[model samples]
Target: MEEMSTILSDLDEIKSALKKSVTKSDLTDIVKSIVKEMLEENKKEMETRVKEIEDVYMRKCGDLQDKIDGLGLEMESLRELNAKKDTAIRNLNATLDDAMRIANEARSRSNYNEQYSRKNNIKIFGLKESNGENVSSEVCKMLKSPAKVELKEEEILAAHRLPSKFTNAPRPVILKVKNTDIKSRVMKQRAQVKSAGIRISHDVTLLNTRLVQRLSNHENVSQVWYYNGSVFAKLVDSDARIKFDITDDVDLKIRKKLRHPST
Candidate 1:
């Protein structure tokens, strides 16, 4: 009877344990909890990966921005240097212009001085050279034969034939008259002497020759000639003398109406 009672008590305890331990609702709840834990772990892992990506991209973006800033600084430096170079080039150009202006002024003064030195000289061609001949006597005799040169031999300061390397071309005679009146007289009789093939001209500078030729091409310039190594111009109907200056471009039309009575 005692053994039967003990066995019956253990069976009852076993039944109670089974009834409390394994309900279907509790089983479902446990599975749900396990799944929720796994999902939370997966979400944490994904967030870590996302943070890593963000960090990598942020570093790259920072590098790119730094490069852009460095390039901006370099560009600014280059612009400043280019501006300085432009200023330097402009200064050099201005200095060169000043140098050229100074050079031109010096050349003009030199040419003017040369022209001034030869003011009292005259050149005559077609007079043949003779050995040991008195040039003044020859000139006076030649002047009297066809047309009288109003100047006396005593009034001649000096007369000589120009030295030449070429023999075929006749050497011209250069004469310096003593008095201004005699020199004027000789020059005024140039037309009379020219009829006999005598060429009388002022000992003009090379510049004057070119200048006279340039002015003679103009329609308003009737007579273009040199006197006293300087170039002179005459209007078509006027006798007023115009000094042809190469430095200043004076229009001939303005001087055309300025007619001085014939001297």
Candidate 2:
């Protein structure tokens, strides 16, 4: 009976140990707690790492955005500069084109036209006159015609050189009253007047009449007037005498040798 009681005790003890081993709730709870702790730590670490990564990414993105913004500003500046340059180039080309057109038009007009010197310049031309005294009337008739001249800047300076407009006008015209014989002598001299060097002293009135009639025939005579000692005649057919003034030009002097045949 003692041995059987001992064996029953041992079997009871084994059954209790087997029951404790089969119902492992406490161990499972401990393992589950440990896993939960590990999972929480891992989650925190992952969250921190994710936050750090996001910060880094944000910093890089900000820097990239700044770079992009700077590049955009630079591009905008370059575009503006290019636009200004193009505008300036276009304006310059337009100005050049306008200048060229004006130059061409002026050139075309210059071919057929001529420019004359200002007034106060004497022009020399032909005229009809009975004597040296009568050339003034012929010059007066010629002055009615239009004068053509070609003047330059240099010629204007040359006229200042001359002392007088006419060399023969140093003395005034001498007029005297005519006797009855003077009319008869003038009428007789009129027939052979052109060929012979015969000159008859006549009244101032007769001289003036003959001068007026002869000068009216010529077209080129510009002006005729009595100034100093002689009559002056101006011509308009050519650019013979109209020129610029100069300081050292010919002095006004009376020259009797330059007399032409009376017309």
Note the Cα lDDT for every prediction shown.
Answer: 0.79, 0.44
Candidate 1 Cα misplacement greater than 4 A, ranges: 1-75, 163-166, 217-223, 227-243, 248-263
Candidate 2 per-residue lDDT, tens place, 79-167, comes to 99999999999999999999977775674334213211111223232222344444333322333232211222322222111135665
As a whole number from 0 to 100, the lDDT of residue 74 in candidate 1 is 93
Tell me the TM-score of each prediction against the true structure: 0.62, 0.35
Quote the lDDT for 189 in model 1.
86
Clashing pairs in 1: none
The sequence of per-residue lDDT tens digits that candidate 1 reaches over residues 1-263 is 89999999999999999998989999899999999999999999999999999999999999999999999999999999999999999999999999877876776677788777666677889876678888888888878877776568878888998887778877889988875577677788888889888888877767667777778887777888765646778777776777766554646433444542432
lDDT of 2: 0.44
User: Which 10-residue span in candidate 2 carries the lowest summed lDDT?
Assistant: 245-254
The number of the candidate with the highest TM-score is 1
